[model samples]
Target: MEIVLYIAALVAAIGFLVLCVSLAMTLTSLKKTLNEVSGTMSGLEGQLQGVTRETTELLHKTNELASDIQSKSEKLNSVVDAVKNVGESVNGLNTSVRRITSSVANEVEKNEEKISQVIQWSNVVLEIRNKWKERKAIDEGRSGYSNFKD
Candidate 1:
């Protein structure tokens, strides 16, 4: 009976030792996994910081570009306004020219008969001048022949 009690006590002690060893191994593996996770989190944090900085710079550049475009658009608007004014002035000039042309056409139409009578008088004067020249030439020829006869 004493030998059996001693054997039972030794077996219980061995089982406890085995449980402790297994617990220690499991704890060590869990520590290594935790360390790998910490390292990965640190790398991700650094990458996130870099991305934030680049995003900030890109946002600033985009704002500057927008401001420049707005300024140019304002200048372009002024140019467009000037072109519109020029078009209006040209339209006014065209209207004035049309009015003057219409007035001249109306005056010419009103004086159509007077213009025709003036043209007929000019032709009659030209015909009288031609007739006078022919008479002078005939008188000179007669005087020359009489002198030859004498």
Candidate 2:
């Protein structure tokens, strides 16, 4: 009965030792996994900082571009205003030309009858002068002397 008790005690001790060894191995594996996780978290933190800096720079550039575009738009607006003024001036000039042309046309229409009367008077004067010259020539041939004699 003593030998059997000792054998049972020895078996219990061996089992306890094996359990302790297994627990130690599991703890070691857990520690290694925790270290890997810690390393991965640090890398993630570094990437996040890089992204933050890049985002800030991008925002600054966007603001600068926006201001530049605004300034250019202002200048373009002035140019467009100048073009509009030139177009207005051209329109005014064209209107003045049209008014003058219409006035001249009206004046010519109003004077058409007077112009025809003047032409008739001129023709009558010319015809009278021609008749007087013919009479003078006839008298000169009869008297053998002309009014144009020096």
TM-score on alpha carbons, each prediction: 0.62, 0.55
Question: Where does model 1 exceed 4 Å of error?
Answer: 1-26, 118-150
RMSD of each: 5.5, 7.3
Best by lDDT: 1
Clashing pairs in 1: none
Model 1 global lDDT (CA atoms, 0 to 1): 0.98
User: Residue 44 deviation, candidate 1, in Å?
Assistant: 1.6
What lDDT tens digits, residue by residue, belong to model 1 across residues 1-150?
999999999999899999999999999999999999999999999999999999999999999999999999999999999999999999999999999999999998999999999999999999999999999999999999999999
Which 10 consecutive residues of model 1 have the lowest summed lDDT? 6-15
Model 2 CA RMSD to the hidden true structure, in angstroms: 7.3
Taking the tens digit of each residue's C-alpha lDDT, what string does model 2 give over 114-142?
98999999999999999999999998787
